[model samples]
Target: MAQDFIAPSILSADFARLGEEVDQVLAAGADIVHFDVMDNHYVPNLTIGPLICEALRKHGVTAPIDVHLMVKPVDRIVPDFAAAGASYITFHPEASEHIDRTLQLIHNEGCKAGLVFNPATPLSHLDYVMDKVDMILLMSVNPGFGGQSFIPSALDKLREARARIDASGREIRLEIDGGVKADNIAEIKAAGADTFVSGSGIFGKGRAEDRNRYDTIIGEMRTALASVGR
Candidate 1:
């Protein structure tokens, strides 16, 4: 694997102060700033958009913005995201009617293009475009909302995706998002995920039983991640 794991998700950040929140995480050495764009029709929750990415760039956020679009008719929105200065634009393969062309459009815009797979989506969906994209996102949880628990089955999917990438002979980056935390991060890393996305894992209020243990959990996650050469 690679020593580049921490991709902090902005979904768990205080959106009212998004710029400041982004700066804080960037200052903490976060590799990519993960942005989740949700449409109510596609995932039941509606969230940020291209304007936010433009705003982040205006605010001088230098970290690459990883845009994860959980919406249908994704083609209609890719251009706006690219124009908004998104360094990497990823769309759900299940949501697009023509995944190949959509990915090509993203690449043509001079940005790294990627595809996202919901937990229930099969690994084979990536077969055609597996070599064409710069990265592949495997959702470890359902995509609708933030703060959801990580699904363990996604680890098996990650393993399979790694196999696919390896067999394809392409150096595509593999990212695991949803319900990621300190304890299981190593599992995903061992499974060949170099990029890790943590929403509730890094910023959600810690478990009620743990009582104000967020910092501890974050530290442990970082330490474990560091050991894996991430």
Candidate 2:
């Protein structure tokens, strides 16, 4: 597997100055702007939604906003984000009652769609939706929060998904979200993930002075990738 740079999570960005924060991230060489959308029913927490995505676009964020929908009945909300200019929308397979319809709906809306599986969700859950997705996000920590510890158990599922994609010979990307930082990045990438999500690890607990912490983490993660010849 090849290594890829971090997709820094923007959930920790200061909402008061979102545009400037996003610009700062881009200046730091972030590959994607990760958005965490949580509906109270599905994830016990409520955060931003499609409206925020629109704001990000309106504020001139050119990097793709990779929207992670931690909401149920994804079909109802996907189109809104699509209209808001999301480049990708990923929903957990467990959240949508009709996974196929949800995946197709996202695709029909013109944004790349992906299926996410929680740490306890098995890889076989993707058997039916594999061909319908552009990417797969395997959560390395429990949803509903940021900066949780990485679950080592999740790595096996990532490898299994990679094997399935390889056996099918499909060009799909494997992504890992939560608990991602410099120390474990290379090992996780070696396990077959090329896309990564980092929230506190990127924005550093919302203090501007601590922004360098995120920068340093990203730099070291890239250095590890380079060392591994990825």
TM-score of each: 0.91, 0.93
- lDDT tens digits, residue span 1-230, model 1: 44655788888877787787677666655678899999998899999999999999999998888999998989999899999989889988878889899999999888899988888888777877776798899998888888778898987898898889888888788999988888888887877898989877766644357533455655677787677643
Error of 1 at 218 (Å): 4.8
Clashes of each: 2, 0
Q: Which stretches of candidate 1 lie over 4 Å from their true place?
A: 205-219
- The lDDT per prediction is 0.83, 0.83
In terms of TM-score, how similar is model 2 to the real structure? 0.93
Candidate 2 regions with alpha-carbon error over 4 angstroms: 1-3, 205-214
- What's the CA error at residue 89 for candidate 1, in Å? 0.9
Model 2 steric clash pairs: none
The number of the candidate with the highest TM-score is 2
| Model 1, global lDDT | 0.83
